[model samples]
Target: MSQNLGLRLCLVVLLCLSGCNAFNGGSTETASITPAGVPTDDPNATRGLAPGLTNHGVVDSIALGDAHEAVLSNTSFTIHGKTTVKYSNGTLRRQGERTARVVNPRDRRYINVSIYTQNKIRSDQKSTNNSFWSNGERVLVALSSSQTNSTTYQHFESRDPQYPILKYHPQKERYYTLFQAVDTKVINHTTNNGTTLYRLTSTEIADSAQLIEYSMNVKIAQNPRNLTFHAVIDSRGVVHEYRLAYTATLTETNPSTSVRVVSTTRYTKMGSTTVDRPSWYAKANNTTPEPPTTYS
Candidate 1:
């Protein structure tokens, strides 16, 4: 297939994978485990013991370290990632960053915006409903903006979001997949608004190979060194916030490079969020889709 056509086809697949109104995103959000099966053994009761070693009933039931996508669709959320490479002498070699904010995900009318930059160069991205950036041009799919608004979705340009475990975890589009194949320990636990929250941590224990297979200059994803993952999740297995960072040394370059990757995600205003139409689409926009009062 030609390069242009290939790019277009890739876009189509990604659109479907991203939970388009027609596709229901990817895997339907699984129902949260009921209260009966939920363990009520509070970790806070055993305050004398060390934090991470104590197995809170809540953590085991939810398998906090697993790759489970919380049911937060149609909610307002922001995800960001930054990858930087520098020479051993501390000179910047390359850097890439990407960010996205979704107003009402999986709705017909929405404002989902994303920006990707590599070494200060930005890619051609636009904030329009039912459209895509196809090889530097905006191509609108027939997805109705008034009916089932499918927003243009783009992956991070700074890094491939790739890992060594492909077959075991194929859904790279979902940022949470980066946490797969690891173990987590409850470092802290608390309650707010009658919701139980647990703060967890992990370090360099992910099941990955010693070397990244097809890494760019900043080779860290597959085999992150000194990996630090901090997750704040609720009782129902919902992640409210997460931060992960790791460092690596790249010897492929002349001076030998140091690499660092930091990723952060936050979910807010779920189930009542409203997306403002992009100025470009606001004039043509006749209707805006409001998030459902409740989501799975």
Candidate 2:
């Protein structure tokens, strides 16, 4: 594979292993508040929350039926975010921004994603753009080449569910097992519309053993470091924002290299957004469809 492709693959793998998202631009009304029915001083208060808690009965008792369902049941939503990766010495390596739109009505699901990388900008006012579209089991992807000013399309039948979207559903056992809340706090947040939301903050960590159990391919020079996650869930059980960060040394090379990656995702205007079929779908053919590639 080419160097650029290799680097892209590595980044994709890293972001997948580290759960990512956090909303920005929300107003903060108060520094802290205590959640009802849960003791702030007790570290075990969040023992049965989805995405962390193992006790099913306790999860049902909470105001939020299922944290993931709020996201899954919505017919339309949009996620815009950026991820940055840095080397051991704090030098920038790779950075990219991604936007995804998901529309699910009845049993049919549609998703469109566009990713832009900072490294592939050309002087001719051209740039590399990779995009993906999926409708249920059918998938189409387009990769633009700066050198040729042409785009290549790959169509295929995807038996595996689309990622990041599929991964966002916290009801899945694998997804739930990836996080354990270490701290729970409440904060008063005011939205742009002046609506105040009682947000519960959960600080979570996933250790090396948990990562291995999840079958995440993470290479580390020494013991794997824990992945830190912070989420802000409103009183209504909606996860308005989430952020993930991790740093580790890779031992696969002769001399280990240290790497750090951080990503943030936000959800807004839920239940009102719309995602339509891509215009390029009409031009795609599946005669020699290639396997789908996952990018976070």
Best by TM-score: 2
- Estimate TM-scores for all models: 0.50, 0.59
For model 1, residues 1-296, the per-residue Cα lDDT tens digits are: 25334434433332222212111112323223232222337655443222122333222322432323335442454333333334446655443332233443332222222222223234222222232211111211222222224432332121111211101111223433334434566655666777666666677444443212212322323334677766666765665555555566666545655665444445445555544434444323333322222213
- Candidate 2: tens digits of C-alpha lDDT, residues 1-296: 26336435644543444332222323312223344444445567556344422222113323343554555565566655455556678866545454556666522334333333334234222235566666656766566656477877666677342333433332334334433312334433344343234444443333455544332344443344555555555434555555556565656646877667565556554677665667777665544665566756
lDDT agreement with native, every candidate: 0.37, 0.48
> Over the full model, what C-alpha lDDT does candidate 1 score relative to the true structure?
0.37
Query: Lowest-lDDT window of 10 residues in candidate 2?
Result: 52-61
Clashes of 2: 4
List the candidate 1 regions with Cα displacement exceeding 4 Å. 1-70, 74-105, 108-176, 210-223, 282-296
